[model samples]
Target: MSSQPPEPPPPNPTTAHGSDRKLRADARRNRERVLRTAQQLFATEGLGVSLDEIARRAGVGPGTVHRHFPAKEALYLAVATDQIRQLVAEAEALAASSDPAALFTLLSAMMASGAENVAVKSALVAAEFDLRTAAPDVAADLTRHVADLLDRAHAAGTVRSDLTVEEVMALVAGAFAAIRHIGAETSRDRSAHIAQLILDGLRPHPR
Candidate 1:
């Protein structure tokens, strides 16, 4: 009898690395959708919105939402982390600018964006968010950068040398608090106007 051809080896599910990779990609996509939907809903409706609603909006199941976030607090933290990242990026971009007025303008804009995002602010409070706590080295770096800019303006007789960096930070914090009290759009407009006024007062008078 003719010898039978050796049978091909059976397919191995465990060897399907490509399949595993596809599964991971799908999971990541679902998680991202959940986060995006949650952020939008939270901004519009506040953090009290239900997880089921978030899942429905995201086109994911409740199970998927839980799997990704575990809890509302965790999701809030994620949102806050994202906002911090954006703020850091803006700061880095503005670091190279030579004009103190322009730098202050950019900083004010960034703060306005933060004030607009309700989820971000909630997350910040939930996380006990401090500039120094959220980003350790970043606080010092930013302070030094701002100080340098202020110094330049001061030397040029455009800004006051008497104001400390701590004082500047206090002013920024007050602006943020004011923005929080008013609606974001209103807050942003008012804050920008107020900031300009503060800057004017801070500017040195020509001899």
Candidate 2:
């Protein structure tokens, strides 16, 4: 018999959607686990910590880590990217209030996170991960907010006129290391102590 128009391929719309949704969910969970594990290990062990270790700790296969991050640099950038985004958001939010203490308050919070912050920042710098290249928008946003906060505080006579955001970042990095070595039992105590010291240094003195 003459063949009629061939039947179209069977539609599996519901099955396709279900499979895709489940896949997306699994991917998201895997990525989050990898990121969390990476953050912890990188902070604790520096950038030299292997991807294998991260994958193992995350309870995923090496293939999974690679699936999420094509390369180690990408993973490192992702971590720093998240950090910079947070820092930018914090600066912008605090700047909105124009509270003279906002800049110092932000510094307190940064130091409060302890040397993990320092180590991560250090690793990124050491790895030469270009913030502008990897996450230009967030990096530029962070820079802008930082400049805004420092300039405003300086103009208001709340902060030293000669002080710069560069100085503040460097100072916090140093202070974080010191507090880590101090080995305080409580982060609250450590944070407060570091915060006060930083604030003291940032205070405007009579010329």
Candidate 3:
């Protein structure tokens, strides 16, 4: 008796597409892991940390990091841009909230984030990579979120009446510079205090 092997099942496009999507999702996650690890290392270990070290810390292969970033500058830009995207997400959440003090909360987070990543930001600046120019869409999205929060604060009388979104953005940049200037970037308490002073200045003054 000739026993013919069972016919192979027909290819399923749906299953193939699902597998492709999963692969893309995994790649996105790996890239994000590299970005976060690079960001922490750059901030704590300075910009001298190697990509291989970042891969080891991120639990990915060196090849993966290289495949995604290619160079330190690319990783630097990705880290900085990732930080801003996180802030934009936070701002979006705050915008959805009914809390009147969301603006201050969001601002505090922004300052803390900037202080934490001051090293990376400085490295990018040294490399002449302005995030506003490099990642304009994400940068603009964050700015828009800040503007929305500022408007809400104005209506709620939470922030100063004279304050504008540009000034608020400038204050964040200034906070980063001040954190770097006093070498408080590594000192959470000191950097926070500086941010607090800046935030306090944004409050409505009692006549």
For all predicted structures, in order, the TM-scores are 0.64, 0.68, 0.92
Model 2 per-residue lDDT tens digits across residues 51-169: 88899999999999988788887887777787776777788789889597777777776666544555565556778876678788986787677778788788788888889878877
Screening candidate 1 with a backbone cut-off below 3 angstroms (N, C-alpha, C), the clashing residue pairs are none
Instruction: Report lDDT (Cα) of residue 20, candidate 3.
Output: 97
lDDT of each: 0.68, 0.76, 0.92
Worst lDDT run of 10 residues, candidate 1, spans 179-188
Predicted structure 1, TM vs. truth? 0.64
> After best superposition, candidate 2 residue 54: deviation in angstroms?
2.6
Candidate 1 residue-pair clash tally:
0
Name the runs in model 1 displaced over 4 angstroms. Answer: 1-36, 97-100, 118-158, 182-188, 191-202, 205-207
Off by over 4 Å in 3: 1-11
lDDT of 1 by residue, 134-154 (tens): 656656666666676666666
- TM-score ranking from best candidate downward: 3, 2, 1
By lDDT, the better pick of 2 and 3 is: 3
